[model samples]
Target chain A: MAQKTIAGVNLEVTEDGYLENPSLWTEEIAKEIAKEEGIELTEKHFEVIKFIRENAEAGLTIRKVGKSGIVDIKGFYDLFPGGPLKISTKIAGIKKPASCV
Target chain B: MKKILILGAGTGGTIMANKLRKSLDREEWDITIVDKHKTHYYQPGFLFIPFGIYNKQDVIKPKANFIPAGVNLIYSDIDKVVAEENKVLLEGGKVLNYDFLIVATGTRVDPDETPGLKGELWHKEIFDFYTVEGALALQEYFETWKGGKLVMSIAELPFKCPVAPLEFVFLADEYFTKVGIRDKVDITYVTPLPGAFTKPKATKMLGALLEEKNIKVIPDFYLESVDNKEKKIKSYDGLEIPFDVLTIVPVNKGDDMVERSGMGDDLNFIPTDKHTLRSEKYENIFVLGDASNIPTSKAGSVVHFAAEVLFDNLLCAIKGRELRAKFDGHANCYIETGFGKGSLIDFNYETEPLPGTYPLPGIGPFGLLQNTKMNHYGKVIFRWIYWHMLLKGKELPVENHMSMAGKKKS
Candidate 1:
């Protein structure tokens, strides 16, 4: 059980740096996490982060996020580069999607 | 009762056993399938083992588990197939006659085919990810490995899962980055192909991916031999690439039995009709999977699609009816680009991989030729499907032929 502190808040995280309790997530914590991943948060990143947090329990996928009207397929890639859904959801404070390989 | 003998109880053999047993009347047909080994492997899972994504337990299962009821499962080494007399010779000199024979003895990576590949450095310095032993060995090596010049090469083309070498490099990039040593490592992908992949469209996109990751591409290098003493691989045209650790996809060839049986091409692959999957030399025999010399990417998806057509054509052959089911060389594979994202590609004999949605038009849950986490999930989910629905010979939702409904035609 590794713990990480972000934005003055402490939370449990997995070996891969994903939040164990996504409900502990906050906008300030999201900014800190994204900064750690070498991303500077913008309005475009927040749109995907907000969408994934709202639908986190629904097993949202990259295609679902791209089709959710927040972003297109290429737009999703442009925002997050490599891991759009996984990184976005992690920033939004959600359990890592099980379907992601 | 007529006897039907199927060689090699791998993916193709297992599916054929289940499909044929259900189609043929038990009173009139006796089904028997044979293989050299008893353990069935999810070969695509082999690619993930070195990356620590899958383990030995995840990829291995008993061959007897999926072998359907009413089919005689024989576990032994194959000696040769006597197509002239329609009989098979086992290693112990036992003989079994067959009314219909199916050869599915898939391809194997032969390190011996390449000079110095099996030398002293073999599994220690030089590793291959094609087999379980190779993959596990590489896993152990990479665990404590300090980063340096890591070179990945393909000794030849027409290997199993053509996209696998590219996937290996992609996953390597992600793995090293996670371990915080990405800057310390230099990755190079050396291939015999002109680009990253076989098709034109896929090569362009995948090649760009290699560049983006800073993995150098050394294309059109025909491997002459591995110089273990110098710690470098020499190409035929005298290009040498040095490596701290060398991973290779060795020369793949059909089973040695195909060569001794005298029913194969120069590489021991059986001459199979591109569309019909029937033996070019014999009418009562059929070839499927990596054993057939079909101009398609030899992957599990190809085997699954070919099985559908082969089952129909085999049934028609038994009834003395004109064979009609066409294979169309439909093959698809998911390219794992690591970081929990993957890409999907779908193509047949005629079409190249295009950018669009797949298995549906306009409103796809899975995108094709585009890297997405959904495609990555689709790739991982296939392992379960391979074990359950595919080996059981149940129909999948995807059609057996290629469709252009959602593709961008340019």
Candidate 2:
């Protein structure tokens, strides 16, 4: 665990830069994290992020997010650009999706 | 007499039947098992069939042969589990009520889920080794055909026997070389995972082996559809790879009955308690093996270890005691790396596969994460163990919970 300041809030984060405590996340923090990942936070992105944050406990997958009704898989790739699930979950203030062995 | 209904007489269900029947009296408890299929398949043997190492006869036996006497075996299709009524409706209008239920329906490959996967190329240029038909078909195809681009793609995540595809490629390397087509064959592994495997040390080790064998690894390629016209597979992210022969682990899902009963996730796996192995919704219903979304590899070893935990918990449930036995998602796999050499891995929910001796600290006949001939022998002899001991629920020397005694922290 490491401490990092995102949007003026000191928060604990994982080695891969995912938020350790999802509850500490704010919209400002998400935008700041998105900026670091070279993505501009759009309302549409936030909608997908909202879906991700809500369902993170249930387990998030690219297939699950594709069927989230907010976006198709192609649209998701366009929004996040690379490694959609990994990047989106980072910006969504959740831990990286496990490999689900 | 109270009834104990066990569904799907595969590895998990069969083990439960054997264990439960031995402990529970026949006069007080009626143990009944239901499965549509008559033949019990040694699923691990399927990996060898495509390479002509094992045949259909080697892997198959009558399901009734392993089922103990005094336990009822009903070979029929299950309609759905009416958990509320504690009864299951069979296809032929047979209603069986149960005091406790064991769900071990397992998982199956659904090629139809991916568009064009089940098209003209299916069972022709494309095959899956997960089934007897697919393995046999691939065997016939390999016998006549000259080698070209051979692509082994995993269509989805959390599929059964996570190491099987890696084993397939390793075996292919040896098989083709022996057939004098090693240079002509181009082997590529395509997977949705970011690397050759999920873990760090194991991935590094296996990735190096793949590199050494000249097999290409294509990571993070989430397959969307197969372009049958162009003989290419397209990813959801717009990447495409052409193939001469495509062997795929198609989308794996639990039995359709779980979906019909409204008790499964999107993949049809039951929502189960990872530790207790009980259904999240129904108290009397316990899930086992690949049928449950347990966040672990869906393999026979996992089923075997989990069956032990489930047996203890179910016994507790029957006696109106607290479910004390906890399954830690212990999974052990012997990876066939071809040419009479193999590797082994043992882990659980919290631990990743580490390098060391296994079952006995510093004195393993089988080495964990080390490619050796002894590990190959362990896998080779496992077929006998599976039939004679494992299905009978006879105690094996290995502990049900994963032990860290032998594994190195690094």
Candidate 3:
């Protein structure tokens, strides 16, 4: 149970640095997290972050996000290089989804 | 009773032992499986240990647990295979005469083949994720270490799980980012191949992924030796890469028994028929997995697909019929890109990895050459399937031969 204070807001995080509470997420928090991940807060990145935050409770994935027309699979990779869904979800302040190993 | 001797009770040998035990007449045909060790390792799971994704207990089980009741599991080191006399000699002078033989003694990481790979700093700064102990050692090393230049390289080609090194670097990126020090750690991938992977299309795709992750790829650099004192790796072409942590996939060679048997190529891999899986020099012996010099990626899936073809050919040979089964070198791998998603690649000897739906034509829960969370799930789920279904010789839905139905051409 680790705590991280991002964008002047305090929130609980896991050892892996994923947000523990989805409700604590704000647009400013997403921008700060994205900046730390070496990604600028562009409209495209915001589109993904918003989509993930909206569907955060249902457990959204890159595939489902791709099918939702927010972005294609390749665009998802372009948005988040190493891991699109995981990074996006983290920036959106959602709990880390399981089955990622 | 006629004995069917199977060497090495690993994945392929265990499957053959279980499959043949049911197929052959139990009263007349006797099956004997031999290995030096009692524990059977789920070798694919070794990739996840360094990142704390899988523990040792999850990947290991007793060899006798999976072997069928009818098969005799002998724990002994092999001395040599006297192929001419159809006999296998154990180290303590136990001779086994067999009507048929299956060589599944898989390849092992030979760090000694390199000049300075096993010197001082072995397992400290230099680590290989191939063996169980090495993977565990790396787990400890990765923890409590701050950030620096982290390098992952392959000492040579023909290594087991050809995609593992790539997966390792990708996982490193995700792991470092998760630990909040990805910015401090610089990751570089050094390989002897011209691209990120062996196949052309896969190279283009995976190479791009590496570039996207900001992981530098030093391709076409043949490893000459390790400079242990200087903490650097020197390539034969006069190139050198220095790193604070070097995770290397060492030069893989077949069993020492293969070398002693005088039936293997220069690297001690048995020269096997590409299509039939039969031993090139012996009529009654067949080679599978990493033990065979079959110009294919020596991954577990290749062995699983080859087992289907090999078992049919073995049955035909036993009945004195023409061997109709031909292995098309069908190999599939689930590449973990970390962060909960992965990509799947399905290709044979001829076709390169293409973008398409997999296991279905128009519809797929999994995508080929497309990174998705489902592919990650597929990779994780495979561990369960491998132990319960694959090793027990149960039939899976996937075809033995590579299919072009769902794939897009280039």
lDDT of 2 by residue, A1-95 (tens): 89999999999999889998999999999999999999999999999999999999888888889889999888999999869999999999998
Q: Is 2 or 3 the stronger prediction by DockQ?
A: 2
DockQ of 3: 0.01
Candidate 2 segments whose C-alpha is farther than 4 A from its true place:
none
Query: Is 1 or 2 the stronger prediction by lDDT?
Result: 2
lDDT of 1 by residue, B1-410 (tens): 99999999999999999999998999999999999999999999999999899999999999999998899999999999998999999999989899999999999999997789889998898999999999999999999889999999988657899889999999999999998899999999998766787677788889888899999999867676899999999875567999989999998889999998998765678889889999988999999999998878888899999999999999899999999999988888899988988998999887889989988988777888888999899989999999999988898999889999899976
Please report the candidate that would top TM-score against the real structure: 2
How badly does each model clash, as a count of residue pairs? Answer: 0, 0, 1
The complex in candidate 1 yields a DockQ of 0.01
User: For all the candidates, what are their Cα RMSDs to the real structure?
Assistant: 19.7, 0.9, 19.1
lDDT by residue for model 3 (B1-410), tens: 98899999999999899899989999999999999999989999998999999999999999999998989999999999999999999989999999999999999999998889999999998999999999999999999889899989888667899889999999999999999999999999998666788666778889989999999998766676899889999975467899999999998899999999998765788889989999988889999888998877898899999998899999998988988899988998999988898999998776777889888986877899888999999999999999999999999988789899889895
Give me the overall lDDT of model 1. 0.87
List DockQ, one per candidate, in order: 0.01, 0.72, 0.01
Candidate 3, fnat value?
0.00
Q: What are the per-residue Cα lDDT tens digits for candidate 2 across B132-242?
A: 999999999999779899999999998999999999999999999999999999999999999999999899999999999999999999999998889999998889999
Q: Which segments of model 1 are wrong by more than 4 Å? A: A1-101
